[model samples]
Target chain A: MEHTWDFAAILANWRVLWVGLQGTLIVFAATVTLGLGGGLLVGVCRYAKTPLLRLPSMAFVEVFRNTPVLVQIIWFYYAFPILTGIEVNPFLAAVLGISLNTMAFSAEIYRAGIQSIEPGQWEAGRALGMAYQQTLRRIILPVAIKRILPALTNRGIEVFKMSTLASVVAYVETLNQAKLIADLNFNPIESYTAVALIFFAVLYPAVQGTYILERMLRKSE
Target chain B: MEWNFWAVMTDFDLLLLGLVNTLKVTALALLFGVPLGLCLAVLRLSGARLVSAAAAFIIEFFRTTPPLVQLFWFFFALPILIDVRMTPFIASIVTFSIQSSAFFAEIFRGGIQSIDQGQWEGGKAIGMTYAQSMRRIVLPQAVKRMIPAFMERSIELLKTTTLVSTVAYTDLMFQANDLAQKTFRPLEVYTVVALMYFALIFALSQLSIAVEHRLAKSGDSTVR
Candidate 1:
């Protein structure tokens, strides 16, 4: 095949792609914050002794962790409205699906981190008259969070990649915009290639940094 | 609105066919991915610097890019570039095989590296070549440790097959789209399909956990 590659069309549609890039960033920022923050709460609940807190949190983690994110997104976009008499837009659906899924996955990571801490640390906190929440906040979580930084970073990377799944429901993200560019210019090669490069360019450095973080953490511990 | 699951049940066969296709693609991808991953892992650990560097680049490139983008590249772009007809099934298989291989390669590397140096030296003492040692001694041990990680990645690959639905492949998710449009029951159809996926995936996850526990009990140190 002697096809000449032309990236000029993709370059010409930079404005369209830029808007999509902004949408992608917004979704990423929203979901990553919500996901990780909610994950901590769910993680603590999963660790709680009360069945009321622990059972529901366990179920939440299992269901969200096991199911495909795309399925969750589609369900939210299509079914949630009918079930609740509430309308769901593309952005809200995407945010709910991605963030909840991230929450489930990261909850497990946080739980593992907490479990890895020595019992003595908890005892010392109680000895100092710290309540459960205070111990979790001031001492246990501070240490647990550091130990699980790499795992949490990996989850964050997955969240960024998952934001593209928003495009499935007609959300105007990078891949959706790339699809538009491909359709407009008959340049799938350049359009899709650009999107792939954009993701790789953004994530490759983060992944490398994770390796460095892991090694440093290992040495310190 | 009323919940009418019977509307979905009437078209359950379509969803079942979709589920079959989903598993088919996942199985095929694993068939290709595991061996390819082994090759990449070995190449990344090769004695030659350039060869190892090239392998590392491929692994990182695929690892970092989203599988959805890779699918579109193969389905829409590669055919034009290579002058070959691209089917959704082919594009899906090709994309996932390579994409999952990158992940599996890391598992293989970690599993291989986790082996003690004495094992390799013992292989050398027995006058075994590097390839022989890897094939006969090191890999046997490494693969046992890799089982949990391998299953986890496979489950991930299974979930990822949903992307094929975007390219109009009649996977479970795609079938749900069709049935919902046909029946005007997006709520029931999608809900049913989600449950179906949940059932399948949850079973697999429980099975993996069981295997991990058994491996741990057997005193085999498994890699994640």
Candidate 2:
């Protein structure tokens, strides 16, 4: 049996798809902002060598990084409310889930970045009478961030792709919106194809931009 | 509600069933993915530019796209497009094998590239056919170098089996999600599932490290 392709239905639903695009952007923005902020703190805590902070940070990274993100999302949507007695909006829950998950990964990336610096850099800063905090902020961190940006950017892209899973929790992101349209219109192919194209449009450029940035940074070095 | 240790223990059968299915998918994915990946890798490295480019595009497409979307496409979209129905198990296996081959291709490519140019020339000097040299000389060394990467991808593929849950596959994650919804105890159920995944990946990683150390020691003797 041959099913006729319908372009008109998709065209009519353009507004819905556009709204879905907005949702995707919002979630992506929120996840990047919060994930990076939380990741930075977690990374720093892991590096600090304080027993209280280091142990917990280590555990958090290991657990989150190892498990699947889909399971974590389900946990947040279903379990977090029971644990905390506070309801989370689907968008917030998705943002928090993706952010926390990416944080675990970013923390390790940051730790590796900081550790990859030559020990002599730290020693020279100390010999120059710079305080530990000053040495790190002024010398170590700048070098480390520059060196790790490629790895970090790659992780950021992974998180961006992963944001599609937010649909499972009913977040109305691009994929979720497409799924809804498909269910309503009974055209899963068109709906999902459009969604895939939109995702590729957004992600392809970001990937190219990262590569360009990496090259420019490398040239400067 | 109080913790029902006995009730949870009795449900061990359910968990065990889920674990069995999970292992089945993981093993099937590896069995299909590794050999296909190797073939794709060889195809990409073939002297023919069109073949290499085609292989590269397929790899890039699969690698960059989300596996969940790919799974959905295989499970839902492809049948609509082609008018052929696939069982969920078949769809899961096909999608996973395709997805994993992209990763394996890159790993194998890296392994092949790491071999010295002298080895290829040495094989030619000995009047061995290219295919025979690859089989007898090049591949054994490449396989050694490829082990750590192969192990890493296996761990990733194992975790990715959770995406099967999206297609309503009754894997471990699906069981956890169902149990969480039923018991209204998401944390406990998911935590258990996560711990199971962690244990398996950790053990695999440790095994990879042991193999890597052995490979490094052997390489040192050969270099000397």
Best DockQ among the predictions, by candidate number: 1
Candidate 1, after superposition: displacement of residue A123 in Å? 0.8
Docking verdict class for candidate 2: medium
- Weakest 10 consecutive residues of candidate 1 chain A by summed lDDT: A1-10
Task: Tell me how much of the true interface, by contacts, candidate 2 captures.
Answer: 0.44
How far is B35's C-alpha from truth in model 2 (Å)? 1.8
DockQ of 2: 0.52
Question: So what's the TM-score on candidate 1?
Answer: 0.99
Query: Would you list the clashing residue pairs of candidate 1?
Result: none
Q: Which stretches of candidate 2 lie above 4 Å from their native place? A: A1-5, A213-221, B1-6, B213-224
Going through the candidates in order, state the TM-score of chain A alone for each one.
0.99, 0.94
Candidate 2 lDDT for residue A124:
94
B1-224: candidate 1 lDDT, tens digit per residue: 89898879888999999999999999999999999999999999999999999999999999999999999999999999898989999999999999999999999999999999999999999899999999999999999999999999999999999999999999999999999999999999998898899999999999999999889888866622
TM-score of chain B of each: 0.98, 0.92
Candidate with maximal lDDT? 1
Cα misplacement distance, residue A212 of candidate 1 (Å): 1.3
